[model samples]
Target: MFTRIASALLVAGLLATSAPAAHAQTTAAKKAAATKAAAAKTAAAKKAAATKAAAAKAAAAKTAAANAAAAKAAAATPVAPKPAPVPLTESLASAGIKDALNKGIVKAVQFASEPDGFNMNDDIHIPFPEDAILMKTTLSKFPGMNTLISTFETQLNRAAEAAAPKAKDIFLNALANISITDAISLVTSGSTDAATQFLRKNTEAQLITAFRPDISAAIDQVGAGKAYAKMTSQYNRIPLMTPVQTDLTAYTTQKAVDGLFILLANEESKIRKNPAARTTDILKQVFGR
Candidate 1:
């Protein structure tokens, strides 16, 4: 019986020791499984982060490329040049008219103030009185009467030449008095001699009044009155011919004024037609085209 009890105790002790060892082994296996699961989770997270970073980098690169392409396209496109500023009609008109008038008057004055200005120009050459045709017809029949007539004609031309220099101040004064609206009208008018016509219309009476004194002085200086008297006396001596009287000052002054206007008109027309005649910046701005 003692031997049997000892065997039982030994077997029980062995079983208890085996049960504890099995429990410890089970705990170690559970801990190793948990560690493996944690390692898999960490690997998955790292892979996901790498994928997101690569996608973000690729997207950023794509955006940069698109921007570069857009920039290149902009560089390749051609840009239009800016247009020139246009001038105002009113400004153009004033400038053009002033320039044209200045040009015309200057040229007219130059021609008229020179030697044979009125005497040589056929267009303006002062002829003997139209009313004195009968006197001329009767006088030419006589011998020395023709010479005296020629002398009278020459003196008439001489008086005109002497008086032409005074025209510049008169013309400038008329220009100064011109209204802005009037200047614009003259420039915009299609007529080539519009400015000249304006001057003729406005300045004729004034010029006639102003020029008479100078013309009268010129007539005396050139002895035009005495020459005209001699011719009239010779004609009056003929019994069959009616006696003739001429207003030498009046005739010469009228002819000179007419001649000045004719020359001015011609010069104005040239300025309108010829680009070379546009001497000023304002002239070119309005009429250059």
Candidate 2:
């Protein structure tokens, strides 16, 4: 009976110790499972966040691409052409003529009034008078006569240059008095210097008449008169040579007037053809088309 009781006690002690060990093992397994589940959950959360971020980045890239395409399409589109201007009117044409004439006169005076203006310009340089060609030809044979002839020609040009400024007032006065009856015809005439031509036709006689006194004064002032007298005196001294009598003042005045008209015509032609020469709004309005 004591052996049986001891055996039971030993068996019960072994069972009790084994029960505690089993309980401990079960608790350890539960804790390990919980930790594993928590790790899986955290990993899933990180994966989900990464997928969402990737989707957002793709959407942004798509939007940027769409915007770029739209911008490119807009840039490739063609723009509409501008409308044509209205037909020119009579009043505008008249205004244009006045403006062009005024501008021409201004430019003419500026070009011809300066020192060496007429002397240097090949187109307008006043050579010795046509009637005095015999005198010039005969004088060329004499010693030192070439220098005198050249000096006299230069003096004539100098006189014209001195008298050029006086023409501006005369030109403006003529411009003011003239009527543009056929202004549209004049403007659309296709002639480059039509306005200048019209002005010359109407005003040339009066201009010459008004301009002679200034030319005569300028001739005396520039020593052209004394030069002419000296030339004539020298030529007259030659034996058996027909006396070369030429009107110096009349020749110089007419030549000066001719040069001024030529310059004015050129200026008018420039305004008609070259857009850059149209300095005023009225000029541009008339001629820019």
Instruction: Evaluate residue 174 in candidate 1 and report its C-alpha lDDT on the 0 to 100 scale.
Output: 82
Models, CA RMSD each? 26.6, 14.9
Clash number for model 2?
A: 0
How high a TM-score does candidate 2 get?
0.72
lDDT of 1 by residue, 1-289 (tens): 9999999999999999999899999999999999999999999999999999999999999999999999999999988886564564775677678777877787887888788888888998999888888998887898888887887787788788888878888897788767778877887679988888888888989888888998999888888788777778877887887678767788889999999999999988887789887777777767765
Worst 10 residues of 2 by lDDT: 176-185
TM-score of 1: 0.68
Encode model 2's per-residue lDDT on 220-247: one tens digit a residue.
Answer: 8878788789888999998998887888
Q: Which stretches of candidate 2 lie over 4 Å from their true place?
A: 1-78
Cα lDDT computed for each candidate against the true fold: 0.84, 0.88
Evaluate residue 63 in candidate 1 and report its C-alpha lDDT on the 0 to 100 scale. 100
